[model samples]
Target: MSRYAEYRALAQSLGVDAVALVPGPNFVRLMKQDFHSHERPLLLVIPAAGPVAAIVPNLELSSFAKLGFEGEVFDWMDQSGYAGAFAALARHIPLGSLAVEGQVMRVFVHHALATAFPGLKIVDAEREISGLRLRKTAEEVAALEGAIRISELALAEVLDDVRIGMTETQIEGHLIQAMFRHGASELAFGPIVAAGENSALPHAHARDVPVQPGDALLFDWGARHGGFCADITRTVFVGHASDEAQAVYETVLQANLKGHEVTRAGITAHDVDDAVTGVLEASVFADRIRTKTGHGLGREVHEAPYIMRGNRQLLEPGMVFTNEPGLYCIGGFGVRIEDDMLVTQDGCRSLTTFPKGLRILG
Candidate 1:
């Protein structure tokens, strides 16, 4: 929100003058401040929309005015759809080949571009906008940090409800209640309350099966505050961890540690993934490292600079991401450790810290 200047600078880099941003100040706040609500008006607000010029949205949203957008505030009122509305909008776009968001913009309004403005060239601004959001501002980092703290508190309160003979549905309800009590705006994603062999699935949802003493419970969850989210997963043993469980958890822990160690400014996200793969390859159960090492985290739970095989994007200060490495064995069990990280100047800081070593839960 405080980055109008930054957006303008990006516009200058892209060689465009006068960006056409969709109006609705309140909606912008919702996108910036609420999870699952980040998609609205997404296509029209690319930071690189124009050079030293921002098309002020028609709808007034004073909340973001605090960020200082003292430039040209223009709009097409709902009533002026045909008069000074659309035509007025066409007049302000000064660039011959202006950039526009095509991905997240509503399909209904898309016709306005191709049919109404036959000469204007709207470039794909999604990547530029997403890239800008990949790096967290200080205020944005603080918001995520607060969200993480609340998530940790909620997880701690919900652990007691996990017991032998307890159904995954029952446990999920308790967890949701705890998250609400701690002020989570939403669940980062649906609570993953898998037990026993069900733990093998990485994205399992809470099911109706009753837990047994020997079940391996995997709690992969997150908490949302305002618009930011924190995802963390911790696998626990119902009675006593089996030998296979112990070995798999230790391997995952080693990979998570390596991922954390290599995560620093100037390093590419692929570096983290490669480091994790190295650990997994050296471990006895090497082939089971099922998913990409991790991904960048922020406004959207999953975004840019993904920690995968071929990514070359380097880490930078104020960039926030997740390091979630997992090992899954079919029909038996799985082990995972996930944490949010902030890339500082020299190294990165872990944002989710809810004890990742094996937990013996009864």
Candidate 2:
């Protein structure tokens, strides 16, 4: 069934008059089009039974028309204000209770929608909609794999230019340039280039501090390909590795591997988090943990099926997420190993192949 058809069925099951989408990933998935956030509100409503309708800005009519929209379109110009468009859409669709992206739709848009249909109920169906994009198709997995390969290659190229006197920000520049040179369409997120004390800050902003000989330089970054993303982290020594650093690295590496080992169909997300965190809690570096083990990764850097404590979402085939576990010691050093994984029929397969073992780089 088409995505719209599937959504219509879901809305019918929930007894909602329609399922609405705003400008974001859900819009991209259903419409195969990109819509930017503007002062004028744009909404696409797929009723339980009828054609899909939209409330779009007059300037965007051409863009929306390209979708070959099969229903009525209520468009208003900037000078006219959007209230008329909302009212026209309301008159056409006529809602009882409409389902919307509770997490995404803006309050102003909601108010406008409520004003158009008095006594209208707006139900949150974020889960039902987001769930549609949770499991990736074969094409998506391949695109993610391509993105990971480009990210790894870019890191390798930048590593050749890294030296002791270079600041973290300088290294970030080198990495970004390399990512583009290596054919990455876009970056999943800003590359994290941290060293020494800065590395202890899990989500550290790259600073001007010169990398030292004994510093643990943590590099966390990803690349985008075909709209899919890959997130990977690797912590390497600048010149020499200390015993303490090695121990911490090994412990975190074990936790990362444990996270992968415990991931498979039928396993609860909490179980995987518990098993991974268990590996660290059993060690003396337990207090070093500063963040959740990992998070879902795909079109957006972070999505559904987050890997954290108390989440009961089950692992399923085609689901992809990160398996990163880190140890951070304030004013000391930090180590993290992150790899994207795809849940398979039995277990999970790592999408990133960057060596996890300690690498001593200049």
Candidate 3:
């Protein structure tokens, strides 16, 4: 059955008239169309029964039609405001309680929708919609694998030329070029090229600072392929590393490995996180830990079934998540080892394989 049909069934079960989707990863997945966001509002209405309806700007009518949209389209030109289109949509779909992506829809659009149907009851369906995409199909797993392959290939190519004195931005540029050469549809997220003291920040931005020997060069990056994403992180030394740096690297590596080791079909998401944290807490660098153990990965870089403390969500087969553990010290350096893994019937399999062992580059 089509995703829309599935969603319609879900809406019916929930006593909702229809489910609305805004332009984003979920919308792209449902429509299978690649289009940019526009100033004009566009709403896709999938009702419990009958054809779908869309309110698209006149300029984008042709592009939207590429989906061969079988539903009624209420297109409005730039000269006319979208009020009429919204009214027309309400006339067809009727304004009752409707499900919407609370996370992706803009406030202006929500207000416009409320104006269209004064009695319209908006239900936040973020969890319901996200649940639809929580598990990966065979095709999705293969696509994720392809993305990881491209990322690993890119890292290997870029690391060959990495040397001391090169700026983080330069390294980022090389990584980008290599990903494209290796056939990445796009980057999953901005490449993180944190070095030395900068690595202490979990989401540090690439700086113009020159890489120096003894610095922990942490790279957290991913590639997009077929709309699926692969996130992986590996920390390496710029040159000869200090004894302290190597020890931190080993501690994080062990935690990462333990995270994967404890991930099985019957375990809770918290179990995986606790296992990793337990490993780190036993080490001397326990207080230096940063960020959660991992998060779900797929169409969007981060999704549902987040693997962290306090989450008791069961680990099911076909579910994919990252197992990243890190130790960061201010004014010193940081070490993080991340890998994407797939939960199977028995245990979990690591999808990202960019060697977690500390490598001394330059």
Please give, for residues 63-144, the per-residue lDDT of candidate 2 as tens digits: 8889877788889999989999899888888899999988789999999999999999999998888788889999889989
Top candidate by TM-score:
3
lDDT of each: 0.71, 0.90, 0.90
Candidate 2 CA-lDDT value: 0.90
Off by over 4 Å in 1: 1-3, 17-87, 100-103
Candidate 2 regions with alpha-carbon error over 4 angstroms: none
lDDT of 3 by residue, 219-249 (tens): 9999999999989999999888999998988
Instruction: Give the alpha carbon lDDT tens digit for every residue of 1-362 in model 1.
Output: 44466656666777765344443222254234211222222123333444232323344345435545444444444455423433444565534555544444555445555444567666666666467677688888988988888888877877766778889888888887888789898777788888887888888877899988878888887888867888888888888888888988899899899988888899887788999888988999887768998877886677777888789888899888788888888798888888899999899899887888688885
Candidate ranking (TM-score, best to worst): 3, 2, 1
